[model samples]
Target chain A: MDKRILVIEDEEIIAEYYKKILQNAGYEVAIFYNGNDALQYYRQFHCPVVVTDLEMPQMSGEEVIGNIKEIDDDQVIVVVTSYYDPATIINIMKKNVYDYIVKPIEPVEFGATIKRAFESAEYRKMKKALEQERILKLERQIEWFNWHESIIQRNYDRVDRELFSNLHESFNQGAGFGSLLTLIRLIASMAKKSNGNYVIDEQMFELIKKNADVAEKILNIFSELVIIMNRTFEFEKVSVMELHSLLRMIIAEIEKYAGIKKMKIALSEQKPPYKSAYVNIESDYIKKAFHEIFMNALKFSKPSTAVMVFVDMKTEGVEILIINTPEIIREGVVGIPVEYENLLFEPFFRIAKVVYEEFETSDYGLGLTLVEKIVRKHGGSISIANILDSSDISRASETKVCVRVWLPLASEASRGERKGA
Target chain B: MDFKKAAESMQLPLDDYLSLVQKFLERLPQYREGIFSAKNSGDMKRLAAEAHKLKGVALNLRFEELAECAKKIEIIAKGEAQIADDVFGMLEHLIMEIKQLMLAKENRDG
Candidate 1:
């Protein structure tokens, strides 16, 4: 009984044609002879379905629809128009109406259309009700968490402090040497099992053990940096570090997070003589900067795509390119508009077309902004660009977006060493 | 055209259906006047709009001949069909036929 249909038609007889059939079907029906009255009635009564003729006096059907959608984005409207061309019809379909009927419709077809509109409206109402309920529950949970956040934070901080301190002490004392060696031996045996043709000779085992030691030392260096970063914010010391090793370590850590989504991280091999280039950077700040940039590449890319990191040296500085395919943007889902290219680096700015429900707990649109700030602090520049090609039609969906970073080369350290020599 | 059958199919009474026909007959003169003024001023957009409305209304009332004439005029005025000077004359002829039928029906019923 609550279900109602509003019919808006300029022609009185055609309006009556709809009214007679709809009213006989045991549904409440209201007739408006013009779009203005229809819109006013819609604002007042909010009918579940609207059957409107496309042409009317004082207001066209398109204008009425646009205005009504402004009021209620989910309103279901069925357009009935006698006049249309191929182009006009295509444009009308893109307006996102419920359905459309040409002139000279029979009673049966009209009745079926009404029935479908009613069913769709009911379904939408049910979904909206459920969504509202879920939102209410989440709000309550968030409120409770906010109330107890201080205590939760204090306990988490205590656990982190104790864990990293013990971790730093173990590395300093070389306490895990025996366990590390045993783990390396286990890996070598597993490799031998996987490849039955390979011989389990002592010489090969020695080589594996040597490689494992190098890995452990690199890991210990990373652990030390994490410990110092946690303890203080000041950049205490600047040292020359291998750029590729730093990048490789950060990529390995980030790969663990991407593993949940089956994503891949790839680093292009640095060509010949420049394979192991060094940069003089504060250990903590450089690690933080790389972590922030790499994690963003992981977060924004589709789960199936690979994130690529390419490094090379330029006359001006060391250039790093982080490239990945962004989530495919469809018609309704909000995407980053080209006009917002520069604005994306502004603090707290987020793309309008992002599906908020999909990324409900993502960073407060501050990841890119933070990366930009840190890059600028380190005398570096970062720019974002859409990678597209007009020549390849097949690669349209794989449009790669690249974030490029250029950091000033640490020439001072190299110059000081040369002078000492 | 069968007014009784049209009304029955619509689930409407014969009296209500005849009243709709009478209302359409009453508005014919104003529609003709508007179409003439639009044509005189070379307002094809206005002519197309008027003719499109007429076409829909005529079909609903089972004025088949009038509806066909209005449909032609509508397409021509909207520049969808080739413009022929005879279309206006054809619409006028159909309007006269409808007026004659309405007068005859009213006389017989009265």
Candidate 2:
């Protein structure tokens, strides 16, 4: 095709000079003295190659080029400037030029430069089409990721809440296992990532559990989850303060949900003295296990009652007790730990009938089994006993079921007085 | 006692423990001060960040004893945990130990 070209130069010599070169190169050429004239011609001809001087009286090359582009984006143009300034360069870039030349020009270089410009314009168009395709591909991936994130997040939120009240009702006698709750809160958040992976890796656990303070909490969290996963486990030692702060962050993150569910939790002492307590376990496992337990408890229990969890001092160490009125234990799961029966901590082992009925939605019978395993790993025992019997005079069944978890699971403690594990 | 002097007196590496001690001492004035000054600041989010940072440094250094003290300050800073006279007492003990360590080092070096 005989490409149409426009020459816009303020100097007579440069204008005539461009017309000669483009004409020699087999282009149909038009020449003009000012930006206004070129633009006027441009609007009429819609020439693709409009070579123009940057400095002009009637209108600047930049303004002319901008208008040309707004009119037709595919138009290719070259700018000629006398002196190059940073602003001019930026302005040129913004104006979207094919190529630009400084004065005291070389004819051959200018031709080659213009040729390169045309090639690049073609290249850029191709690249733009390519980039758009890439974005669409990325959009698909993003859409998929967002879908998974939402599902995981929803489950994460729901499970964390369930753990809170359920743990309170089961272990705490209305109030005190603040530190234990802090630890449980963290594990609950981790456990809620339904689509993600959590493992009870021993080495990572050993390193994490070097600190004495948070070891028990970590152990408790991981132990619970490990049982849920039905796997071998190790306890880790990360700071309880970090864990608790994480909890606070999670609480703050899901502040809306807690408010919605009217779920609330308070530390036994408000400000527990032990921030750097040890959680002798893997974080992910503990979090998952504890969250599952709480979720079931909350779902299965009667709402509107404060599920209280508190830590009390025991002669052996600390006792983190999750006291809840189970009011219902279906005979079978926690039944005398019979044949392989030692496997109550297995995934989906709901000892209490209330659990199955309540958490019928996620029929995964592995929450309490996990809690049992988690408690055992901490070298502690969890007993699901009755507190208030169903006072039906004829039936005379226990009304309140107390799942008193005599956890070494005691709450936060003072420095240097750690109970021997 | 000055921490630097304590390390020097005890023949402990002055620079070795100074940074850790320096980090701890940075918050001494905070524990002594007893209250965060951003009274109108809606919450202690920033303070919590600061406290979180202190905890990492405190625990990593294996300054278990000192770390315990910093944890208290962190709680108070968190607004959920309050600072008490005992927290100051712990901070004071850490400062005194570092100072004594420095003094012991200085005496040995001298």
Q: Evaluated on chain B only, what are the TM-scores of all the candidate structures, in order?
A: 0.88, 0.50
Instruction: Identify the candidate with maximal DockQ.
Output: 1
Residue-level lDDT tens digits of model 2 in A16-68: 44665666667788888877777778777665467777766668777888888
lDDT of 1 by residue, A60-148 (tens): 88988888889877777888877556676677777878888877766788889888787666545433443454465477877755754
RMSD of 1: 19.2
- Give lDDT: candidate 2, residue A117: 59
Chain A vs native chain A, TM-score per candidate: 0.39, 0.32
Worst 10 residues of 1 chain B by lDDT: B1-10
Clashing pairs in 1: A334-A353
Docking class of 2: incorrect
Fraction of true contacts kept, per model?
Answer: 0.68, 0.00
